[model samples]
Target chain A: MGITRRSFLRRAAVVLAGVAAAGAGWSYLKGLAQSANEAPDQAASLPSAPVQQRTPQPHHWAFVVDTTKCIGCGKCVAACKEENNVPEDPHFNRTWVERYVIDEQGEAYVDSPDAGVHGFESWPVNSKYQNIQVVKSFFVSKLCNQCENPPCVQVCPVGATYKTEDGVILVNRSRCIGCRYCIQACPYGARFLDPNLRVADKCTWCYHRISKGMDPACVEVCPVGARMFGDPADPDSAVAKALRENRISVLKPNLGTRPQVFYIGLDQEVR
Target chain B: MQHLTRPVLLLLTVFLLLGAARWAIPRMFNQISFAIQDRTVPVGTLLGAGGHANVPQDIEAWKARQVQYAGPASCTQCHQESVAQWKVGDHAGVSCETCHGVASDHTANETPLPTETSSALCTLCHSTTLGRPSSFSQVKVHQHAGEATCASCHNPHNPGVQGLPTDLIRPKPSAPLVQHVVVAEANCTMCHGQGRLRPYPQDHAGWQSPGCLLCHETGPTPTLVGASATLGAPFAGLVQAPSVPHVTDGVPSCTRCHDSGAVRPFPQDHIGWSAGVCLLCHQAGPAPAVGGTAVGSPAAGGGGDAPRGVSISTISADGLPPLPHTVVGYTQCQDCHGSDQFRPFPSDHQGWEITECLLCHKSK
Candidate 1:
């Protein structure tokens, strides 16, 4: 039982390994404890979200755009950018207006220069587009669908992207990893990576404005009253009344997103 | 064996330290962006399983951030000339956003205010597209502008491309109309006296009337005034200008245009009641004879009773929904009507006189 040189070395090694393993184990346990505490806090906070949304109960806000009434003035696009302080880059738009032109042969052409932030001008004098003889032409505005079961929320690894109880899909800019999973998951191409903030950005339905009982910027500035916003659940709400009265369709309904934003006078060619 | 064990042990310790740093550092000092957003995002965001529960509050909070229409008043300081001009012309009542996009976009950045250079710009409100209301100032832009910008020929401020004649004595096929934007500064004769563009009062005779509205507000009917009224018929007061100096007795003095047998083509029902009929429906209270020679000189003993039942076009088909022909589109009622010209308003119509005409004179 007396100490030999080889056996002594082995004993010292085992002691060192034990000490190191314990230190590493302590940190691991600390992490687990913090996560465990956070989970309960998250759960508590999560349940309250839906509750708060319901408190304004029976008031599920929604939006509707009447394509027939839209005059392609670019007022909504300009208003959206000015309201949200979105960067000027065309690619970073939270909302935009697109024009469609169908030719005599039943061919459709679409273009949105600068998201139609500038009102669409007539074709240039004797340009190719003018000669094409557009049989049908119209304008349609595009924004975040704010789906009831949003894939953007589901794909957010950090729970950065989420839905408000009112059904507004919003992003926690701080929590987002900028991995762009939500952007990829959005079926409507509504999501974009804000280059300035380096986070995923999309339409908040003028969340800052709508919450205060004011219209979203886009709706406020539309000259023709084409873009409409209101609570769908409230029978008296404009969107609700419109939905009740008008034939409406949502973009990509087959995906089962249950979008809060609806469209009136939607043409078959609009995607 | 010792040499290998020492390196392996060091490597393991370093890996553990790295893992701890990764979890601990981020957990404590996650992107400050998160902190900022947490404060900004009103509660009830779709951050959870069922989404934002505080729908009422979160949406309420966010609503404040919604963008609003900065009206022409907002742009007055920056665009004095444009707004001032717009305030006066046919477009005076139109929203600046209707043509200029949003005010924020123009004011925030030096994004030059967009100029409307296309036919589409003017045609949005002016185009004679199908399904448009008859009261709207509809125009066949394809036939009119002919690939030219409406602003080129019309002044956006004062879109009086066709100065109307003050009197329309003849039967005009079409009346003079003004639109939002059109030939702004075209010369006087560009449309007025020109043969092709001239809007003659009578397309049938190719003759211009004295003025489209001089004799009457709208197209005249073949029936002379009160031709169908028999003895003692009630005559509703007329809206004619008071300057005509006509008598307001029981009988409507039709001498203004009724020249007895001199004027032919009376209403079918007026076959027997010639313009020469003397004091049949009226009392000779103290006025001149019917269709008398001297103007404003009525025979004595005027004002009589009602023919219990006579066939006179009811003072108008009033109390009925507005008819298509009476619409002027320029009526003061259209000011508050926006696109819905028929929107009911409080009896207290602000500045403009919502005349007796608008009660049934719907705009096109």
Candidate 2:
């Protein structure tokens, strides 16, 4: 009984169909496992026990200035420059305050500089727009809004940028491939490419101070006590309490980056 | 079998190709790129490049013309007083560009460019803290409710002296007699009982007594008896040995004993029986007699024989002095007068009293 050509053809087709069906089954199972393990809704509900249960370690954390409280003092910017040894020509690892004033007639005036230590002098002026009776003014302090669900983490192929257990997002400079994905993914425009290191950099939340049980440079030297920091999971913590007591909002909620930084008393004029 | 095998092989190849196409098609179409100066680059870079570097050089040239400016030094010159104060302030080192928008305006304008400012401008630098001065009012409240400007409490010019006044008020001290007791428990009740009353027994009466304070009310215990009582001595007998010995020597009489260079005498011109010496012989007995006429007398009727013809002059009660010795102001008297003279003075006199004078008189 020699095998017929038709019989051989049928057997080959059956083997191919079986392989395809198996591949489809394997794919379906892989997706099911992923869904079961990392359900988005369940991830959101995961107990933030580390923040809630443990004794709060003293940390020199930082805040994302809401642009509302910012009086454009630039005290933070100046202190950061002096403390961090920021470059003179093109400032490195520092922040500055920006002032935006809008008149009732909808004229907008904006001003900023690379630094702000001497003090803002050109305020209390009229807007560029005409017939503006009322003026809405705000000072936005620009810095990193260390996000919990940082898109920078996802895009970093080398796992250089990571979220610490204390919820601070930091970059292991040694591991960074200098791919500025983290910088681009950040909505607050916090990260920047360090010209000297040729790698992406931003505020470190003063990790050195935090390790030694002192406040970050900006928080320590702030004249008016503006930036606040603490574990957001603990209800009694200042950052958490502030969020609870006041009407708070984050920047660019539509992007789905779960930013831990919060702002209070935000004005419509602020971008 | 050969014919069947050929058809089957062709069909299997077709199926594999179809499956690969399904997976690869969407990803290939979704790939995006951008054109830069007629050259192609990733769309990501084209969108991410900030306008500062991305815009054409011609556009940058045009934007530079519209820049506004103001110098921080202009304000520092006019506000010298504030600058001097700000020099010492915590925010002293901060530069002008920090809070103000920029200086392009002042540079462009022949006249000073008008600037816009608000409390919101201050919050850019000042924010809240979790510890120490916990709840900071928002910029709106700080400006409106506190009626304060950044310069009001802080001097941006000098950054020193901050907002604190140079001449601060100093608190005045209370009167001497008023006796300000910081720790009331340690100073007040330990000496004077509740309501400043003397405990009991009129024999122990002193300046601090309820009776004496009725007239002489405004002074610390002045007399030895009064001083001892104010310091809570058990009895007058205990007054000779300093109540607070760690603070001062046992001598209680200020004037009688402390007159310039006079060496205090014992046994001869001593006048009073020393309670310190009495405590040496009569270790556990009741407090021995001190400074009165009855002291040093033999205990009635021959039980302890009195030494022959020893007439010791007792200390006076009305602040008068006892009779002076012929050898005036010597610390010891018996060196000149022999043991026979000491025997004549008093028997049963414990050896505790200083008897040798020459032992201390070699230099004299």
Candidate 3:
């Protein structure tokens, strides 16, 4: 019997379909087997369970310096020198007491480099003249402002400087290259190169003390109560409370370092 | 062309079947395998199968696992210095995820993988708008060009120590009198009397009352009695004198002989009596004498007798003629004549040629 064209075509199509179905069934089974074998390896390779997120606790610190209560005494200076081992040169680390005199003539003058062991008598007789007869005379103790956005840190090349979570700018002595870039970058001239360590240094805001739960030495030594320290993040912190109650200004606002050190009675000339 | 034969037809059919298998067999296998594997069957395969099971209901599942967040402390193990400096830094509280996004990949990979972060990561916490005050903002710090960064001068683990010791000891003053004077006053008032008189300590009671240091303490102060005497005889004599005279004369008292010139014959126009007058006497040195029969004397009518070329004018002879005198034709005799000839012209008596101008011209 002769086969028709249509019958032959039908037979060919049926054969092709059967082969395709068999091939697909085999491929699917192969994939499932591969996945099962790899599952345990992937699980074993996973890193240790993620560290538990600690619940944040209430930890705050702060400070306060009452300018009205200060009497321009150099007791704080002496204490700071004794505590911190400040150099004898006025250009170095110890805080300098500045007598800000505003005369009736509306002229303002500042006298510094006067506070020492002998006090004002220690000032050089040949030093430059500083006008004193002003409408008001207040003593301002000048030190590192300890800015939030420290320009010193921003300019450091070796990643030696950094701000703490608690809002303190600090330097690691071990890593510091002593390049002094921070000194020049600081708009307030708060940074000085440490001769002993050969590193750029500034106020740490006493991180050593703060971390261990203590007030800074300068704040403790201020006799007239011209210095204050605290955590700004805590509303109850002394610094935070003062910021809420009084008008405080940071040095060099234009530089935008966001100094953590706040001055209650900062004069225009102080910046 | 040959008569119809069954064997020939069968052979031809076999050849045709083999050719069809070459094209269709592999394609059919591919479609069946794709369908069983949960993939959509190709259109050709579906049409070839007469629409039998063309679509697959069990599509392969693609599972994406949940990502894990790693804190900054994890980075510290490898980056000890950076972490140490950061511990005391204002940015210490900032988290690792805050900058590097999810750090799961970095932690999981055995080999170092390329990170997606750049300087922009720093800006997240450092931007002026987003960061706390005192923190550097990318917008603000960029102005420093490339000089600014988080690690510039600070050690992330140990911020620089400020208000540290300077280790300087002030030197003791050389003069005992200066030390005594400094000790006597609460301020500069002891050496310098109150008000304007304080600045001229040499003016009799001015020295005994108060000195110039009461206000003008920073710069040069008029030598007080003790200080002047300690400085030497010249300064002491000048302090004792009423006013400091021209270089030709001995030094004069700053305020004594200088009272408003109304009482004295000298021109009231002396610039030294003006504010900052101490710069005159205490200047580096005395100026040369003007038209005197001294070292810089000018000749009469001689072309060379003009005043010396020095920019600063010296003290003029008080009683001398305005110039073109009978003895000297020119206002400045030193212009034309030598000191020797001019000395005799003025009646070289009292050893005028040898006498120093300062000795005679000294203010009384």
Candidate 4:
């Protein structure tokens, strides 16, 4: 049957519209798949990162921070930058150490000069500091908790920031609208807007490494073995053994975030 | 000419229409651009920039200020000696820029790094503050090397005492006592087994001062066989003095600790000698009188060291006594007096006016 001219025009328009829609859908699918592949290593997608293939493991990961064991070395802070391309601005830390200097008066004054990168070798440079003797000083290391009940995931305007199947909190940069609601929602102050990417960024618990059955860079390079990562479900794991024997606690437990990271010897002064 | 003229006129009319529209355009767009600037711009506008759209400067500078770190490997090329020493040094794991500050811009502009001579810098890691972890060494800044550059006495890379105090070293003749290395896993009951009589809470201040080393040093197992069980005067006299100056200088302000109360008052015997100056009458034993050779009188600065053949009293609290403020052994004031932490040595050899350690202690 011969088509009428008006009908032919209408049919041409419809075909063009279908083609455009199909092309758009295909491109989106390709990007999604690429992102999934890139999930094994956050920074590995970059040209300089060493190529590593992930081996899937059947377990939920957990991290432990023993405050007594932490030396305020700042090694983890430096390693995180190397592993995740974190910015050098000391203020934008993925993980940082807080040195709680409790004076003789029993008041704690916390400071993390340069996020303790070089270490507080000669702090209190002023002689006035000498007058106030330090009483109970210790270090508290902080990072994203990857909470089970993360407010960041719930408050996200779009599903751009969501939890992974393996219980990781992640932001899909492509989908992120940079609304910063997640930053506001995070209780740990772990989230920040990446100036370079203009998107919400935070500690991924080194998703790329964890997915590959490896420890995160911060845990890997800790000099004093203060930070530990392993499958908490396994009784044989170091983290599990530590948890079994010691009294551990999480920050802001009242918030009900159910943070996966636990702390050993958490002091009363620490938040 | 006729055909071209119609097309030209049509194009001119279109331009005229747009120009007129631009002049009379509603304020909605101005408000819309303002809104986009104040809020999230549509995806198309963000990507397109709308050419003249405003953006945060901090975000724009992220790319331009991207100075990649010049890792240790880069510094290794020029600072070969420092790199080599650092690999085996105390801070082996620390990156180069940590102590030197970020060197990426320095590499680009050959900027000088801050000196490591500042006492403050050294104290960041080495200060003898109270709450440090076990194995790390702590120092009272004033008593260290006085004002000398720390590198003068301690090789920063090698990290050992430089120019050994000739007087402090083990003397040539007496030297067979093995140093007991204390392991971390502690169980006091292992040595001082269960049963002990509850002695009266008698005050021992009236007794003679046996010097700082008498009660605070670790020594060979003491012979309680003939010795009195109580940790008082008779026992103090029986305690054998150390052959070397028991590093009392290392714990100068350690006096600050004892000075802060326990019921025990300063020994009455020390009263006639000098107040607060424990070293005047109570001297460290003679040079290390090792195996076989009997310990001699206290060196040139002798102050009637306890009788020879007698070992340092093996009293309570097991053999390991309370830690003396400073390292024990090396009693001669000159041995460490003008050095790090102890510089500005007392004109009269007494550690009296030292409330602030940094006043006397410079980097060295």
Q: Write the residue-wise lDDT of candidate 4 on A165-246 in tens digits.
A: 5677777665566778888999999898765566778887776556544567677667566888887788888899988989
Best by DockQ: 1
Query: Per-candidate DockQ versus the true complex?
Result: 0.15, 0.05, 0.02, 0.06
- Tell me the tens digit of each residue's lDDT in model 4 across B5-52: 565587679979976755554244542222222223234333432322
> Quick one: RMSD of model 1?
17.7
Candidate 1 wrong stretches, greater than 4 Å: A1-58, A122-128, A232-241, B1-364
**Candidate 1 chain B, which ten residues in sequence have the lowest lDDT sum?**
B230-239
For each candidate, the alpha-carbon lDDT, in order, equals 0.56, 0.46, 0.47, 0.57
Compared with the true structure, what per-residue lDDT tens digits does model 3 show for residues B1-364? 1323554587589989976865675467652221122232333332443221211211111111122333354576576766766666554544444333445446666445444434443433333321022212224556533665544433333333421123422343752344223333244553355654344344324342123223222112233344533323323333333332343122344344344223343434433233223222222122233444333322333333333212112333233332221221223333232233333234433534443453334433
True-structure lDDT of candidate 4? 0.57
lDDT of 2 at A158: 56
Task: Output the number of the TM-score-best candidate.
Answer: 1
* Native A-B contact fraction in model 2: 0.06
Flag the better candidate by DockQ, 1 or 3. 1
Please give the lDDT score at residue B226 for candidate 3.
Answer: 48
Q: Per-prediction TM-score of chain B?
A: 0.33, 0.24, 0.22, 0.30
lDDT of 1 by residue, B28-101 (tens): 65542322322222222223343333344333333434233444555666678777666666666556665666
Candidate 1 lDDT, tens digit per residue, A209-262?
A: 555455677776665677888877677666878899999999988899898889
Off by over 4 Å in 3: A1-63, A114-118, A121-132, B1-364
RMSD of each: 17.7, 21.6, 30.0, 22.4
TM-score of chain A by itself in each prediction:
0.78, 0.68, 0.68, 0.81
